[model samples]
Target: MEKNPAVAFNQPNHLPVCDWLNRAIDQGLNERTAPLARALMRVQEQLTWRYGYERMRPGLARKYAYAELLGSNGPVISENLILSVVLFAPKHIP
Candidate 1:
């Protein structure tokens, strides 16, 4: 089994993050466990919500983003690392 490619939404890529995750699910990338795929779906939603709010109000975005990063929505962890990086993300970044 091949390892899954890292999901990178900020970088210019062929597929948007949501599409990429859906495709992976459709391809049974997480066949070993349906939970994994579902977890990823949740991650996708969290990212979408976080980024969306981020554009409107960074303070508001931080609420959802921080929760998502802390895995308040699911069993996923490690988003804290991503949040850490986001904390220092450039103001000009989109």
Candidate 2:
């Protein structure tokens, strides 16, 4: 049996989510990691760009950390399981 790399999203030695976020924080860090900084920045600006100099209250991001966000690489796909008298079958099992 051969392991398919395409189906292994978020796996170590593969594209890491932290790498993506790191590039986003610093535009000149590395082009390969933060290729979509412009788009991400635009989305953030649209969501929270009105604060300016006016004192604003921080909400969810107050306790947010780079590790927390980067550690959220979701599973490649959802998997289900079924149990029966004969044998259990899992959706992810080939």
Maximum-TM-score candidate: 1
lDDT of 2 by residue, 1-94 (tens): 1232123223223122222433344653357636445544443322211112245345322222221111123122223321111111222322
Clash count of each predicted structure: 0, 0
TM-score, per-candidate, Cα-based:
0.29, 0.23
> What shift in Å separates residue 73 of candidate 2 from its native position after superposition?
19
Clashing pairs in 1: none
| Candidate 1 regions with alpha-carbon error over 4 angstroms | 1-18, 48-94
At residue 27, give the lDDT of candidate 1: 50
Candidate 1 structure quality by residue, lDDT tens digits, 1-94: 1143234333122212233345555554547757755765555544433343425453443232322333323223333333321222223424
Tell me, by lDDT, which candidate is best.
1
* Displacement of the residue 24 alpha carbon in candidate 2, Å: 4.5
Residue-level error in angstroms, candidate 2, position 9:
28
Looking at model 2, residue 13 earns an lDDT score of 30
